[model samples]
Structures are given as structure tokens and as C-alpha cells.
Target: MSQPVMPAPIGKRGRAALGMDAQDLSTITERAGDGLRVLGLRFTNDRGCPAERFETLRARLGTSFEGIEIDSSPGNAAGIAPSAHAVLTVSLVDEPGHPTRVALDRVVAFLAEQLRH
Candidate 1:
């Protein structure tokens, strides 16, 4: 039986972002909720989290998972980390006829968006 390797604590920015949250990232999840779900994460190179590579995922979610609502916040903002992989925090709510699709359009489109001096 091969046990999966546990991930490291994270980089400097990851810790900083996780710390800003009072409850911390521990409160974040990725399971179906009572018509609602929230995902706030800082994607690190060490974690293999995707930033602008959710088109297929989004398309699948939109078509297969009907009535699923999603709200996303991805990037390094005030309380977020800088130069991290990608912060993909999303909230889903499946109410009545709302008419909406999951989108990851944020301040930074990709890691290259960050102007490194």
C-alpha cells in the first residue's frame, strides 16, 4: 500500500495568505454543500494547482453539473500571496433560475501577469 506523500507547509506567500484569514484555509473545502460551496486557495508550484487552465474543467462543470453556481477569486491581492501558483477560491450556490457559469476571470490572468521587476 502506497500512501500519498503529504505536502509541505507551503512557501512564504502561501503562509502569509493563509494567515490573513482568521479561520484560516482550514475552513475552505471542495465538496457539494447545501446548494452552496466556497473554495479559497493559493495555488503553489509545489501543489500543481492550475490558474488559467480551467477552461475544460469549467466547461465540464457547466454542462454536466447543471444549476451549479460559482464565484471565483484567483490571484495575489492585498491579503493574498505574491508570485504563488494561483489562488483559486470559488463559491457555488445552486438556487432557482439564476443563469450563471463558473468563471476564473480575475485581476491577474496568468502568473506572467505579475510584473516582476
Candidate 2:
């Protein structure tokens, strides 16, 4: 007789698997206004690396600004893929145009630095 094979254990589902909850997601979504443009750097999806980075940046930036919103796409079927991408938009309460551009640049720079390590 042939022996039975056991299936592997599937990891946690969705963004929670990446260590994020509803509150976190809500906060980010609420913060993103009309002026901010979120820049997402590709990272590992198995561990929710992108979401983690976003949270980290949000914490570092403080709560004075409006907020950051994330729009993520579906994850790939492959194991621990990096296909998931998020668009973060920061709302502008002040003047538009130049001020918003400068803020966006700063946010991008911060994200880049975080991904460096």
C-alpha cells in the first residue's frame, strides 16, 4: 500500500498575515488626502514587507499631517511573491502645487531610505 502524503500548512490570510490590522489600514486610508502621491518600492509579500514599511514611515512622520492612504493590488499565486503594490496619497491642507510636490518628494525619500536596509 502507498503511504498518504500530508499537505503543507498555509500561512495567515491577506494583510493580517503581514502583521497589519483593520485599524492600521483605516488610519492610512483616512490620512491620504488629495495632494499626496504614494510611491511604493517592491518588497517581499510573504511577510507584508511593503505594508510594514508604510506603517513605519507613518509612525516616523507623526500625525500632524492629514494621513496616508494605501491602495493595494491582488497578490500573486506564487509563494511569497512581490507582485503586490500600494499607492499612498497624502492629503494637502495647505497650498497645492509646489508645497504638495515637496512633501511628496520627502515622503518618497523616506520610503527609499527605509527600503535601503
Candidate 3:
């Protein structure tokens, strides 16, 4: 069997834009609350994966997935790293709708599949 692929590390700027500090990103693999489902991913700069990829992913995921980028702070002394990190928020249409654990799983699976190629 193939070993599971680990996500790349995201930079400081990317983390802030996702409205997450390193701790939040570390403890929670995924979060479903409010009207949003948060999915996190780390990518190296060499991958050439730009912010547009998130939009494309959202489109491919269909209406169930909505991408949101929020401004956040560093939250700690950890300086920004050179790598890139991001959180993809998939908000459901209904009230109190958030991405369920299953949905988060699917998103991660989809992202893993995409990254393999």
C-alpha cells in the first residue's frame, strides 16, 4: 500500500488570510461551525499552486463548496515561514449549515487526489 501523503506547510501570510493561527491549524484537522466548513492544506511554493486553485476547487466541488478568505493575525511569536498554507471554507446554503466531518473528509480526499498528479 502507498504511504499517505502529508500536506505541505503554508506561509505566515497564507495562514493569516485564512483567519487561522498556527495553533488552530494544528489542533483541528477540520472544523464545522457557524455557516462554514474549514478545510486546511499546505503547499510548497514550487508546486505553483496559486490562490486560483482554491477557486477552481470550489467550482469543481459545485454549490456545496464556497471559498472564503478572512483576514487574521499571526497570533504568536512564530515568524512567518517561507512555505504556503491555506484554509478552504465550504459554507452550506442553509442556516446553521457547515461542512460536516464527512464533507471535510471528501474535500481532503479530493485535495489529496489532485495533489498526487
Candidate 4:
């Protein structure tokens, strides 16, 4: 909805969900393709929990993200903490027969809810 800029650091609650402390985890909103918006959440310290944590996240996600693609991988970002980091990429595409942009806020909230446990 707005112009893309540098990734913004997520809040305390989100950081806690990601098993991060001190080191920054940030997110950026950008266009992926035609009418596809992507939210890139990047973090350095998963405390080695990416595998189990994200697997659980993926399972709990289920059909909540039916039309969206959420994935994580080892990567790095400029101006982000710790240099080497993991990226949680959420790609949202417009659905046929849908009348509005995908509810990205809901997707993020659902992730937080599923990850908290």
C-alpha cells in the first residue's frame, strides 16, 4: 500500500515468538509480482529453532494461508543485524473471485498466535 523502504524491526511480542533476543528481526513490505505483495521477515538468531519452530508453524498454518506462500531460508540482508540470517518470506497473491487485497495483517497475526506456544 505504501512505498517500499528498508525493513522495519518487529516489536517485542513478535521477537519473542521468533526466539530472538537483543539481535534485531525486521520486516519489509514490497511488491512480488502483479498484485502480489510480499512481506520479508529477516532474523539472525533463531537459537537453532528454525526447523522445529517453523515446521510447527507450517502445520498450524494449514489452510489459513491457502492462497499465500510462506517459506524460510538461510540468507543475509544489508543493514540487518548479525549479517547472516534466516528469512521468513510471506508471498500473498490475489485470489480469483476475491474482491480485495489479501489480509496480510491476519496472516501475520495468525503466525504470531501459532508460534507463541
Best by lDDT: 2
Q: For candidate 3, give the lDDT of residue 105.
A: 56
lDDT by candidate, in order shown: 0.27, 0.36, 0.36, 0.31
The residue-by-residue lDDT of candidate 1 on 1-117, one tens digit each, is: 001112233554332222224343223322222222322232322233332223222332333222211222354232223233322332212233221111233223322343441
Q: Estimate the lDDT of model 2.
A: 0.36
Runs off by more than 4 Å, candidate 1: 1-47, 63-76, 83-117
Candidate 4 ranges beyond 4 A from true positions: 1-45, 65-75, 83-117
Candidate 3, residues 1-117, lDDT tens digits: the string is: 011022332563342233445576434333322223334332223133445445443543344344433222243122222332332333221222332233345566766865775
lDDT of 4: 0.31
- Could you tell me the lDDT of residue 73 within candidate 2? 33
Residue 74, candidate 3: C-alpha displacement in angstroms: 11
> What's every prediction's RMSD, in angstroms?
16.4, 15.8, 15.6, 14.7
lDDT of 2 by residue, 1-117 (tens): 001011221333232232346687456545554333334332233233434444444553344232333222345332222333221222222334333344455576766865774
Q: 53, model 3: CA deviation in Å?
A: 1.1
Residue range with the least summed lDDT across 10 consecutive positions in model 1:
1-10
lDDT of 1 at 8: 30
